[model samples]
Target: MRILAVLLMLTMLPVASAKEPYKAKPGVAGNITSVGSDTLGNLMTFWADRFKGHYPHVTFQIQASGSSTAPSALTEGTANVGPMSRELKESELNYFASTHGYEPTVLVVAIDAIALFADLHNPIEGLSLPQIDAIFSITRYCGGEQPLRFWHQLGLEGQWANKRIQLFGRNSVSGTYGLFKQKALCNGDFLPTVNEQPGSASVVQSVAYSDGALGYAGFGYKIAGVKTLPVSPGDGPYVKPSMVNIASGDYPLSRFLYLVVNKPPGQALPLLEQEFIRFILSEEGQKLVERDGFIPIPERLIRRQLNKIAGDV
Candidate 1:
């Protein structure tokens, strides 16, 4: 009888109240809007869809005006974050310092290759840097450059003498155009009369549909009926732009994708953004990146990103 009484008294003690069940604080969810770089906007939309599976309450609005619009959107207070294909410019940095009182924080999200693709029917197999220089050079752009364009002209395999070379490319606003100009054009302007399509997909489509056509696009945008060319300088086996080659640094035209934020978002929204960025850097995320046809950043880059975030917070 005494033991039963002691147990009942202990259960009734004030300390017993400390073990109540956990009740979570209410979630303060809101929308976050981001815009920039059409080239990357498609990928970001895919990531946002996957993110929504975990966060049903949060809303993400994304748009792709161009890389040039990202910093302006951030400056105007319209977007919480911006996705970009290029680094911020000095003028953009100065504007941000004046308007937002701080420079935007730059975050790299992935590495991608810009590939030169041609109609599958074209006989020429590969291009050396010097040969490519000749092709893009205005002086040698004879109206007769076609299908084989001349094996001797390329110093490459399989020559047909009678075809005219057709060129397709992205509009001047595209980051792909900027990279292509820097890497392939050597700062020379694109050939006059070259067709300028609006997006990478269009460039792919045009090349796939036209005989004797050549174009450039993000490696991820490659499609059926077109052949990606292997490019190198001097004598080489040449290298195609693949995820492995890009991440491994064997592909020379690979470039980094970025997410630019003016300041760390506040507590509630920051958690979700942080989670999204974390997911992108995760094994699952990198796998998705490769599956979607872009290269994951190297492991060393991923670690460096995590460390930078840690330092920022």
Candidate 2:
């Protein structure tokens, strides 16, 4: 299903505001540790700072290694919040379910799209899905007869023709890597030549400075020196990862970002965490989402998540 349509027509429009404000309770204080999703690092920080505004005594510690770290951190009780840019794998979900005797609560917090970034100098029109597969993967399982190693292969001419296609990507532990593998590469293995960056900023910066470089990163990372390529499924029109395109389901790569918590079935979370979550589902929390350059969750999904945590909250 399309990402936006699936999230209760998150495709509808921008979040004007939630139905109510976050009701901050008295003496809400604690340390909140968030682990995972380099893509969500800045966003988590934004939300944390907002939450702290209402509860000054609450401190926060956030780590953004990758989404793979979230399940372990949440399962081991090392983090109060585990933000992920993608859904958990079956193995990760099963492990948590077995260990906790219940599944972790997934909070759909925002929307984002993985952007295929190129150096500003590369004037290529767009890339087809199979071409993307050929550029990044070894197996070429997406109908690529051979690997794409040079710019001229994609129809660039003159000075661009002989330029090598430099590839940058997230490390193995990243949800970006997994999603790109699943969608663009057709689950094929990445080429060994892919320069694996430690975080999203590195990928965006690497592409910005390197000629003929292409990198995949969150759309929020788009800055002055890079270009976001319009990509297609080989037959469809090329679609840019714009907010309108994402919300309209015209952009194929748009996805939900989430915060996962270890709440037991039939149990309300601890007051501090519960209040924090309530705040996240509130109007102001989603404002932080837009501030961070990610799309806010739609109202119905917000209400659905709030109901999951507490009926009255």
Candidate 2 C-alpha error for residue 70, in Å: 0.6
Taking the tens digit of each residue's C-alpha lDDT, what string does model 2 give over 223-296? 89898999898888899889888755578777888889988888788888888888877788888888888887
Which runs in model 2 stand beyond 4 Å of their true positions?
1-19, 311-313
lDDT of 1 by residue, 86-180 (tens): 66778988998888676777777777878888878777777765555556545433222332333345543444444466788877776777777
Q: Candidate 1: where are CA atoms >4 Å away? A: 1-28, 137-152, 155-160, 234-237, 264-269
Give model 1's TM-score versus the native structure: 0.80
Scored by TM-score, the top model is 2
Candidate 2, pairs of clashing residues: none
Per-model root-mean-square deviation over C-alphas = 15.2, 2.4
